[model samples]
Target chain A: MSITAPQGFVAAGVTAGLKPSGRADVALVRNLGPSMSAAAVFTSNRVFAAPVKWSRQAVADGQLQAVILNSGGANACTGPEGFADSAATASRVADRLGLITDNVAVCSTGLIGVRLPMDLLLAGVDDAAASLAPDGGPDAARAIMTTDTVPKEAVAEGAGWSIGGMAKGAGMLAPGLATMLVVLTTDAELPADALQGALREATRLSFDRADSDGCMSTNDTVILMSSGASGVTPGVAEFTASLTALCQDLARHLIADAEGAAHEIAIEVTGAASERDAELVGREIARSNLFKCAIFGGDPNWGRVLSAIGVTDAAFDADDLDVSFNGVMVCRAGQIGEPRDLVDLSGRHVRVTVDLHAGDRSATILTNDLTYDYVKENAEYST
Target chain B: MSITAPQGFVAAGVTAGLKPSGRADVALVRNLGPSMSAAAVFTSNRVFAAPVKWSRQAVADGQLQAVILNSGGANACTGPEGFADSAATASRVADRLGLITDNVAVCSTGLIGVRLPMDLLLAGVDDAAASLAPDGGPDAARAIMTTDTVPKEAVAEGAGWSIGGMAKGAGMLAPGLATMLVVLTTDAELPADALQGALREATRLSFDRADSDGCMSTNDTVILMSSGASGVTPGVAEFTASLTALCQDLARHLIADAEGAAHEIAIEVTGAASERDAELVGREIARSNLFKCAIFGGDPNWGRVLSAIGVTDAAFDADDLDVSFNGVMVCRAGQIGEPRDLVDLSGRHVRVTVDLHAGDRSATILTNDLTYDYVKENAEYST
Candidate 1:
């Protein structure tokens, strides 16, 4: 179950002739709510997609009754014609559901700078609206995938309410939101402001830390819709904590299934002067292609880690820094520590810990090693 | 002809049994000067090598007599003992040449976090000092090769004065200085202060814009020494211009010989509000792995370029951007323009020009395409 795991929600996935593979390419999620409350976040890239511009306005009033998402065309860098296409898509979805156009959101992902096939998309919307069902969560999740190998979904239960989420992303995963599309739903009575705050905080901790590659996308969007069918008003802290956990679970799934990834690595930075510094250090290491390549070769080359850290503005003494691969401290006091041969990197999971020896703050960044498969997949992706 | 192409320079190359391949790995350049005016620049990375730390002080007084460079082991992240080793190497060079220890600088390149074999390095320095001759520039150039496929050398003539340089770097080529070791010898009559100003400006326009892999190194150094043997005091502008051209020539060689690179790409950003903004846009595009991969695959994917520009804080209207590949305008007004098939990337040189249409400022960044061999080389580098 994905968005439909929450009560008072229905979803549908339909085949659209937008992809050459003839796979399902359109998904529709409807909230049969006693009350409509919503919040959303979009890619920070200035040159964003048409669907992102449309959804930004649709959710501005903090009310959304339905969402329509499609894969096979990002509809980005297409100018005014693309924006018009997005508006028409939402309008069609709203008309089919007997709802206002402004209460419908749209999302798109795939090749950029291309116009969406409007006729096929519109027909798929009609099919999806007619096929909406309470058990269509998994189908909806699968329809939003581009290069993702598997569908991702997660849930968190509260006192008498629950939250569910689904995410789709593979390559082009970075901060300012990954090249991804995510939809979340909760069957709890909550104000739009509270939901917005919780979503922002949760995404900051989850999606923001999952930097598979240092490439930000132009068509990323994450939307949350709440239906008051559960009628349970939990404490603000409780809701935010549960939402963060659920988002993290979904984020891990995204990294685990990232395109051509052979290993899932976590770079944890501790003993920093501030949380921001810790994050900066971890992000720098995550973005170091040299470090990632060394990890792929199963070589605990901590020198690359030190070189990456030296490029950041984080507070730390070069001579006091320490780095450990897995459980073996390979570098201490900026010099050789334990024998590098003692570390093992043959597993699919690896952890690199760095002690900055600055303060007590800490942060972790999730990333994947740079391998030939990564280059092959990305080189042949758009072609 | 390389560094010794100038009138008052002698150089030598020697093997120290440090490299497993039994290749020459030690270089020495001596200034036979009437006036020893010198200036230099090192890597901006805080976690620099021991040789960098030692050379910083050696050239601090605006004067130097000789430089000792070694490949096969970069004395970086090697603690206090590494510093001692650098000082000892410099002292040995000074002793052999009958100069003060403070006037001799050292440079090292290769695998980081490893200590140099002091016994071999010191012995090699003695051999290099004894072998120094006026026509040994090419030998010195070949000795500093780590992964470089060819020696890079350039000479700029100005009346009776001339400047000659030799550089060695291949993989860790990025801004903050490409993981390079460069020695420049000039027979012009100039003060240390003038050489310093000219070197900084020349490098800012050349080496600073060459970002191959976006992985800065722990050991990058460039030194310019004046022998004052030409007895010609040319205008400062003429000398600066020649130096800039010479540096740009060497920078191009570094990019052309970059590790596993199939194409040398020049990302030029024009019509920017400021030169800084143009560089910011160009560098961001140069650092995008997706853009690099697309170039390697010979795909005219202009969307990746737009997406990269969108991430920067540069001044540009989303709808006003235009991108051209090899003079074929593939994107105009932020949308598809000419047929992408009209652009061909079968050559070794690719020119990607992005028009921001914001103002009149322009800049260019040199980079290389991402390839499978690149990942392979870096992945198996340390092992």
Candidate 2:
């Protein structure tokens, strides 16, 4: 049911008093392993948080033993002091675990440019390390949440291994991984190179394709660790598939929890010249304000859909394209295929499919409809 | 005054019943040309309206005598029949004026799909021609408006000639000249190539940089015509400067009238490696929903600005970037420069300045804040 369901991993979550609501704001997970190999992917945004800078550098070693995460302060855009605070937090965790500081990773999320509550975070790290348990995954999941309606965690069992993860993101989400911050753990025996390769591929189709608001975050990151405690050593292909599924499930959960979203929309682009082209078209539609607003209003405005794709450089003539909304053929061969009154959109789930007529390559992107609440929530968020 | 406030032109606006409200929905303007040279621009969107296709081809002849415009039903995506309607409308206008059909351009805006009410449009075209007057600019301005709160018209008087224009756009606005439809008329004599060159140069910095909602339209266009009826041939250099100022003025009006917008935000990006880089950075910040929402709520959340720019490919280290919101230094060298409580955004205008520290190039983009009404208006727009 939780990320710690995997073997050889102990985790704990605790309150650091950083959040005014007294919610859990600090989490720790350690790999009690015969071997510790890990890989990580970070936000492509040139502007990065202090913690992200540290974690990215540490992962260059291709191995990690533990990760320390905190919420309520992103420790981003806080200058030299922010980097020192992140390093100090990681050092405190490593010191408590009697491990080398270089073997630990750090991640922080929440409001950007606010100083980390050093006194509270340092104490919370100690508490989390002492309380670490095999069944502490749920608590860890709860600690890394900010404006999320619910805790997102998923586990998938395989023939001999299992994949599990926890994620926290609701806004500032778009391509280049959005504001996603995820941690995945598995008991499979895999090298760091293999894990990195699998993560890049899986994320490209999962988190990288989930564009909720089209705002990339400076703190987006995903780290994967293998404890090698299960001794399963499954084939790389099977492990990769399980990892991909886990990521997809977590992505779905993230989309469902998108801030102020009323409906989860899936935009599918088929018959593109390449998978990249299909993804480009699909993402363009997903990020379109007009398309999203129409979805929110429960209007099957297929003209807006086709118009969104029309601006892209994809090799498809307008007349050669076919668009369907929720199984209704709203447009065919670039012409209005159905009356606007014919399509019913009062439901929660909406599916839009676009056929490019170029090649067999296709892609699907998960997004949320732009709603009144989305504007209200985000507009009032900083205030 | 209106687009024909310039000396050598006459215009008219008439009710055609194209809109159920029985408002003026048809307009006509003619260049009383002793020298009939013109320049025009069309939407870059591949899924263009039928009128756009016709106008592009008609303008290819390097000479234009008149333009006919209608609102309430954009003849877009109606297939071959839509093309026929566009031709028919142009033909009707040519017949009334006794000019070649190829010399008369056409433009249509409003809801997509539904065919034009040919009976109403044809009759209204005749009325517009009959009622054409040198001072009928205001009527023509009113006829070409759809969902616009008011008619947009401006006039600039020079030494011996004048420049006047009208525009209509309230939403679906973004980089590729937004969803705006503009008609500019000048009395000074100039060749079509010079007009075309000036139009392109002015639009590059004016219309192309007005990003209110980041939704490019299928019917965006701007047409510039010279009557040469004044016989006052200003130097090309002076004429181009006047035209550029006119475009900037109109672009500002368009941004001011963006749908449901409560505030106009100006984003300036400086010290980029190239003008393109600066524009890219400025556009990224301008189109950020989170940043726009923050400004809407009067919250000076500066981190959103930095993160938005960081996602671009511009060459600037995060640590070397600085951001200011509404004259308050919120970020310095990619770090928090001022307390959130210190920045005040309780005004109808917001200004954001970003310094990349990479080079000397700079650019500015005008946008409007994302508000609840914006969502409401766009969601129910078509329905």
lDDT of 1 by residue, B1-383 (tens): 87999899999999998889999999999999987999999999989999999999999999999999999999999989999999999999999999999999999999898899999999999999999999999999999999999999999999998999999999888897977999999999999999999999899899989999888899999999999999988788899999999999999999999999999999999999999999999999998988998998899899999999999999999999999999999999999999999999999999999999999999889999999888888888781
**Which has the greatest lDDT?**
1
What would the per-residue lDDT of candidate 2 be over residues A1-383, giving only the tens digit for each residue?
47697888999999989898899999998989877999999998888899998999888988888999998989988899999998999899989999888888999998888888899999999999999999999999999999888999999898778888999998887887957789999998999999999999889879998999999898999999999888988888888888898898999999999999999889999999999889989998997888899888888887788778888998898888888898888888888787667777888778899999999999999999888888889888761
What local lDDT score does residue B229 receive in model 1, on the 0 to 100 scale? Answer: 96
Instruction: List model 2's recovered fraction of native interface contacts, to 2 decimals.
Output: 0.82
TM-score values for chain B across all models: 0.99, 0.98
Two-chain complex of model 2, DockQ on C-alpha atoms against the true structure: 0.84
Whose TM-score is greatest here?
1
Residue A91 lDDT, candidate 1, scale 0-100: 96
Query: In candidate 1, which residue ranges exceed 4 Å CA deviation?
Result: none
lDDT of 1 by residue, A271-352 (tens): 9999999999999999888888888888898999999999988999999999999989999999989999999999999999
Positional deviation of A373 in candidate 1, in angstroms?
1.2
